[model samples]
Each structure stands twice: as C-alpha cells, then as structure tokens.
Target: MIGSILGDIAGSVYEFHNIKTKEFPFLTPQKGYTDDSILTLATADWLLHGGDCATYYFRYATRYPCPLGGFGGRFREWLRQGQQTGQLRPYGSCGNGSAMRVGPVGWAFRTEEETLKAARISAACTHNHPEGIKGAQATALCIFLARDGKSKEDIKNTVEAKFDYDLNFTCDGIRDTYQWDATCQGTVPQAIRAFLDGTDFEDCIRTAISLGGDSDTLACITGSIAEAFYGIPPALHAQAMHYLPTHFQQIVAEFEEKYGPKIH
Candidate 1:
C-alpha cells in the first residue's frame, strides 16, 4: 500500500538519472507516482471488490495512461490491443512490472498459499512468463512472511527455497555492475537484496534506489516488504500521501484498514 506507493514516488525521479550512492534526498519536488503506484492501486481495488483482475488492470491503465514513468512498451501494446478488441489477454511478458505492482496481493491474503495464488493471478494477467509469475509470488510471499512476524533470515531462506531467487548477494556488492535491467529475473532478486540490507522502511527504499537499476520498481518491491517488516513512520506516510490522487489515497485507507500489517 502506502509503503509501495512511497517507494514508487520517491524513486520516480531517480529511475532515469540513477544515483548509485545511498546519500540522496528521499523525495524531490519533481517526484510523483508512476505506473507502479497506479497498478498497485488497481490490484488493491481488485482485492477489495472481487472481479476479474485483468479488467481492473485494463481499467486502471486506461484511466491513467500517461503516468509519470509511463507503462512498459509491451504493456502499452497490451493496453492498445485490449482497448481495440475488448480482449485483455496476457502478453507473456517477463518484466519487473508484475513484481512492481504486486504489493497489495501480499496484504490482502491471509495464508501463504492464498497470497501466492493471488500474486500468480496478478502477474499472469500480463506477465504470464514463468519468471514473471515467480517474481510476483516471491515478492508477495516476502511481504506475507514479514508481516507474519518471520525473522529476516527466515524470509530470505523461504523466498530462496520457494522461488529459486538467490538472496545471497548484497546491494552494495552489485551496485557498480547493475545497470538498467527491466526484467523480472534481473530486478526481483536485487530488490529482495535491498530489503534484506535495510534497517527500516525508509532505509529499504534508499537501499533499493542505490542499486540504480529500474529504481522505482526496485524500491517499490523493497518498500512493500519493508512496510510489512518495520511499518511506516507516520510523518513519512503523511508526506508521501500528498503525491497520490484522491481515489488512490482512499483505496490505501480502506485497504490498510482491512488488511494492512499490524506492526508491533
């Protein structure tokens, strides 16, 4: 929810002009929410009101076609086709878009199995590629585990064992070599590593951005998990909500009220 949206907005400005160092402003005057936030809200809406997840995705994309960072090229085409033919089909994409927008599925479900199923449904709408679905499930499961009071070590091991994503590396170790990779295989593990390195919610977003590869998506993924693990600071939450739309803010409020983590 707000955690994922905060990450998306905070990292929006840095996606193109990537900063490798963690020493940077958390959010700039130029920052705004991207397709990540839009789709995440779409996911939340879908979870709140039961319907075809694809329909929610298409509606959201149609409503906010020109977001700050814009939708991925393949997803753009998917939207185009869905608009023309009234058939919203999966595009077999393996992009990080699936993982970036999957935070709500983590919070909305109670069991690990249900979370994974919802995550799969979310990703398979467009990112039907095996890696894409795996990325979403892995990310959602991390949030589930974190919110369930699992230890960091437990989360790392569970995600690694379940999805085959290596959480063994650190963000600092890969900072120099990591480039702008938009793929799920390249992005999701790194995002997880960023979360693993964080001390708190804000720190997680910073660490994900410092990796400098698809910053918003990375931070979005990291922030979702971090929120479940550490909860958001009240001040930061209020500040970030100012950037979101009225509808999105409403969705966040409703979703958080019903399913958000009860951080201790």
Candidate 2:
C-alpha cells in the first residue's frame, strides 16, 4: 500500500504534464498522494473492519473528496450520487480505477483464492464489468504471488495463463506507442510488464511512468507488485510518508502491523 502511494505521488506531476522517460526527478514539490492511495486505504480499511465495499469506499472518498482525484467520468458521477443518496450501485465500468486501488487486497489475504475473492469484492463496488473485475483480480493475484516468493517468470506465466492478459510486450516496445489510456484492457498488461522488466521498486515505478500513459495508475499497479517482490527501501518509505496526511499514515501503520512488511 505504501508502495502504491509512493508511485502515485511520484507519477502525479507527470499524469497531465506528460513525459516519456524514466530520467525525470524522483518527485516534485507539487507531488502528493492521489485517489489511488486514498481508495487503496479505503479497501484496506474495509478488509480490516468488515463492511460493505462500496459503503467504505464511498465513506472514505466522501471524507477526502479530492476533486483532482483523477477518477474516470462515470466513477466521479458514481461517487457524487453515492454521496447524495448514501447508496452505491455498480455502474458496469471497465476502467483501471478498479486495478489502481486493489493493491491492499493482495496483502490482506492469505490464500490465492482469498485474494481473488477480495479483489472481486473490491471491484464489484463500482467496476462490476468483467474486464474491471479481471484487472483487479489479476493485480491482487500478482501481488500475492510476489509476496509469497514467486519468481517473475512464474508470476508472468501464471497471470498470463489465468487472466489471459497477454503479457508479451517489452516495456521498451510499449513506450513509444502507448498513449493516455485508462482502461484495464489497455493499461494492466503494461503495468505488469513494467514490474517484469524492472530490477527494483524504484525501477519498476520509473518503468511504468516512462510509458507516458495514465502515469499514476500505471505506477500504482507497478508499485503494488514491486513492493511484494523487492520490498520498499526505508528512505523511499519515509519519502512517501512525507506526502500523506496523518489519517492516511495512521491506517497505513495499522494495516502494515496487521499484515507486516513492518517499517523499522
């Protein structure tokens, strides 16, 4: 989860300004946690306390209400309606929003089946479309496998076989042609490829952001897998905490305590 936040903050400045290289500054003064981090917290919050997924998601999103959250149009509308009516109904979305926020589900569960189940629940809150659910499940499953000590080759083979995500392209190949895309179909495979190609957490995030498409979400997905495989550096973790609020940091601490990769 902290990994995902770090990616979001690092990629935030480039999401709109748009860059195509990994050589950019690690972070900018304007960098801050975005909806990816917020929704991930909400998912963790829900998993720990036991509540309806949409209810917790809506509750936390309302509390934060980040206008620059980078939510897709339909998701933004869903949030608004849920805030007003105290209800959230799935609107059949296939956006990468479901994938971007699902990192915590991988950490919170013990078994592959459990991780997949939790991922489904998390996505069903808004992204009930099949592709959206697949994206979330695939991401969560990758995190689970990586944390459980699967090799990158094994992870790639398993995810490709199970989810049919077509993880064949090199990040280098995708970088030149990749445009701003927010769909799971367009984004998740590339995010996975970023992790597959990277040697470490920072490299994985740099790889994702360098693709020049939906930067925050791409890095959000990449960081989830990278953290599981490589763990986060202490300096990087401290750097990320500097951008998060006390409330977010508090939950992050709690979740880490319960699910470990505990900070020293």
Q: When superposed on Cα atoms, how far off is each prediction in RMSD?
A: 1.0, 1.3
Per lDDT, the best of the predicted structures is: 1
Off by over 4 Å in 2: 67-70, 262-264
TM-score computed on alpha carbons, candidate 1: 0.98
Q: What digit string (tens of lDDT, one per residue) describes model 1 on residues 71-189?
A: 88999999999989999999899999999999998888789999999999999989999999999999999999988989999999998898888788888888999999999999999
Cα shift from native, residue 3, model 1 (Å):
0.8
lDDT digits (tens) for residues 1-264 of candidate 2: 788888888898888877899898987787888888889889988888897989887877778886345556787799889768877899999999999999999898889999999999999889999999999999999999998989999999999999998998898997889999899989999999999999889999999999998999899999988999999999989889888789888989899999987232
- Each prediction's TM-score against the native? 0.98, 0.97
TM-score, structure 2 vs. true: 0.97
lDDT of 1 at 261: 41
Global lDDT scores for all candidate models? 0.91, 0.89
